[model samples]
Target: MADDAARYLLGIDVGNTVIKAVLFDLEGRQVGSHAIDGQSTRPEPGHVERDLEELWRNASEAFRRCVADAGIEPGQIVAAGCAGHGNGLYLLDGDDRPLVGIQSLDTRAAALAEELAAEHGAALHAATLQEPWPSQTPVLLSWMRRHRPEVLEQAGTLVMCKDYITFKLTGRKVSDISDMSGAGLLRMPECGYDDELLALYGLQGLGHLLPDLIDPTDVAGTVTAEAAAATGLAEGMPVVGGLFDVIASALGSGVVEAGATSIIAGTWSVNQYVSSEPVIDRDLLMVSAFGPDRFMIMDNSATSASHLEWYVREFVERGGHHDDPFGFCHRRLAEVEPRLDDPYFHPFLYGSRLGAEHRAGFNGVAGWHGEGHLIRAVFEGVVFEHRRHVERLRAAGAVIDHATLSGGGARSEVWAQMLADCLGVPISVADGEETGALGAALSAGVGVGVFAGYEEAVSGMTRIRREFEPDPDMWAHYDHRYSTSRDLAEALQGFWSSQYRDARRENNGEEEAK
Candidate 1:
């Protein structure tokens, strides 16, 4: 039968905490999906890492399970692509063995980041269109060079997360322009590796460690027999150059055209828009390659629905709604409506753009507010943070009349509507639950000639499931809340800085005692 002869595309998404394997047909309908959650170990405060061996094992298991669940022959899956979190350091030793994997959540290079920013911020920005940040690939590499010189001495290749996955699958060391550029390792506009850029970060002689770069839709290599044996895929299947998860989410949400913004409210508040012309501003967080010549101008921070996640993990998980904590959260949020005097919450559990020392808290928690009100405040705080990024985008001359919404926040109708109402823009949620995987599969389709290019692939495969219109009546209310949030954040900067110093002192003291 024709259906039995049909081919499928596989997409793998690697995040800080989850690894997902999703299968999609030529028409972009999901056939089967599986995800595995892996834990990150904190050997030291401010350092977040995952074991390389464990990551590969979990990824392979996810692949096997996904193929089995689809109930299809592995040979029918013609090609695959990967999308992963950007800006972390994944290294291979001189012998090409897994050396270390530092996740993007790490902030071990904070002091170094600040030093680079203060000393050569302008020159660095001119070269890479990004300044030093604690979790940036270059900054983390520089940290390794300074403190852990042995690691750098043994390093043979520096790859992003998806690149590592590609290497495991195809036995090739290669990366895509999107992940490289997003990590600030490539020269902007040109979108190629440059020794001068590395030198700017005091990483002058490490150029050989960088992987070969290719277009996201180009086939990099074929699946190796080793990988096929470890996973349940056919040997010699095509593997496309992969994508940064942010760009994957954008593409999956049908935000390929210039000026269309994509806001992802997951672990990070990722707000970006594709642009034909590159925009460079010191105030902007980053500017990375999107497609062949396009750029994705972005403003992001580790502030988003992760706040609710933390709250649920620490507080709600012990309660009766343990099985479906998020669903319970959504119901609670729906029960509360906005009021002028509602408590203000800051969704900065990890950090913030204001500064790295920033912390999250619920301000003005009056005696009368219940759990529902607090939950609603958490939702509002997350949206307000997104609005902060969107404002920066607009200030940088990116149009934001409307945008696509994806990630955990977009899954909730109430949360999506809140985003629309808070940002005063029409927000559209895409059809699929795993847009990141769909985007990767779309790239795979292009790689294998199942589709001509991204535009055609998106046109054929992606569709909007719901659209949200901003309520003008609620705009004034949200505007007031946003302004207050900004004011409170500014006021708490001094306190956060003090808390950071105390924490450092305590950690140092304990280390000396040991």
Candidate 2:
């Protein structure tokens, strides 16, 4: 390769709300960045989708803008990689035409998930190391088989968001191990498809729909001429297979070592820990394949900053005097006293696994309390939710010494300090703003032999921006508050379970009627 070609690597991150692309030099310093805003299509109450053509177009535009900003010729780029949201299903016909984009958040497959769990009990769990969930591939596929059989019957290939984009660029129908593991098909220890799961789900012949699994740093293929023309990149540029967004974020935040934990506070907050082996707790959840070895244990809270954003928009609409609502809220929170009398709020705007039936509200509010009290209550409630996840991880035998926090939410000093106090662990912010893109670039560097290993690459690139240490007095107060929150969450678990069952039954009855 020419010297100019060896100087730059392109990284693309496909998120639910937007697609981000970054241009990095050989030294891993970000040279240029671009983003394209996109929204998920919600045709019905529970369905979500994106136009595959538009997704590709937006990604291509992002690449063009970033490359232009860098002032580099397209042919100067060396290797490229892509990362994306996991567990979303995208179907393609034999000619690579998109059938549909299955939204990951849609819970139409809940009944199918339960059915798979019932039919394949311990064996299935041992194989996949994951209980059947509505978001899993098997359950989603089962839902399609029953609801939209025509789409499944005609689908010649099944892939996730990143796989589809990679195939569009490289003309290879393949998936990386990280993406495959999230699909509820790959056997955990074996690191391949679980035939028992396939048979149990009546998908024995659906193997063709899956992709060839490759290592996270493997060279999947080179970009084709067609892709090159469309994206304004040189032909034959190497494309590395990158991991899912969670793993990429972990890598970018420098949490590669065992026992190192991170909280990626995006629209949803995912707490992750790298483990030498899979740590299973019936209560805590997992999104594995994040570590280099067997498993990277993870659990997620559906609402985090998104909930905060909602509250800010609803409550602080007219009070826009100084800065952004979030900034204003932070300023207000710092002035208020830490302890409140009787205004405890549950930050469950979209409902939570803890209590789906309960509507979010403040337990006590009076004329004395104003917007500041309400905002602080919401912020504290979110931090308490993080505490719940931390307790769950500890119970599952993962010793989390400290946590590296990243994402848009981590930028707030007040939120970071609140998290530290609530979890009683030191919290630090990641070095860069685009950690996900940086992580994908690091994976590509490893694939192309730019670095010796994952460790060396991260050590040379990742940095910490700010650190928050827990306050003893605040920690003591949060400890009691967290205990109360857990008790409340547990008290509603049975009610939520029943509500879930009833909703599933109602949906199934509607389907049967049709």
Backbone clashes in each candidate structure, one number apiece?
Answer: 0, 0
> Over the stretch 1-514, how does candidate 2's per-residue lDDT look in tens digits?
3664457878889886688889887666789899998767876444567888888888888888898998988877878888887886788987889887875655556557667778775566666766666666777887788788887889998888888778989999888888777666787765787666687666877888888888878999999999988888789999988888878888888878888998977765678888777765656555577445646787765556767777766776656654587877877776778663636777665455443344455756777777678787787787776767777788878787799988777878888898988887899898788888888888888889888888887887788888899887887788777777656666766766686677667766877887
237-333 per-residue lDDT for model 1 (tens digits): 9999989999998998888987889999888899999988889898898998857668889999888877888889988997555789988887887
**For model 1, what is the C-alpha lDDT against the true structure?**
0.89
lDDT of each: 0.89, 0.77
TM-score of each candidate structure, all chains considered together: 0.97, 0.91
How many clashing pairs in candidate 2? 0
**TM value for model 1:** 0.97
TM-score of 2: 0.91
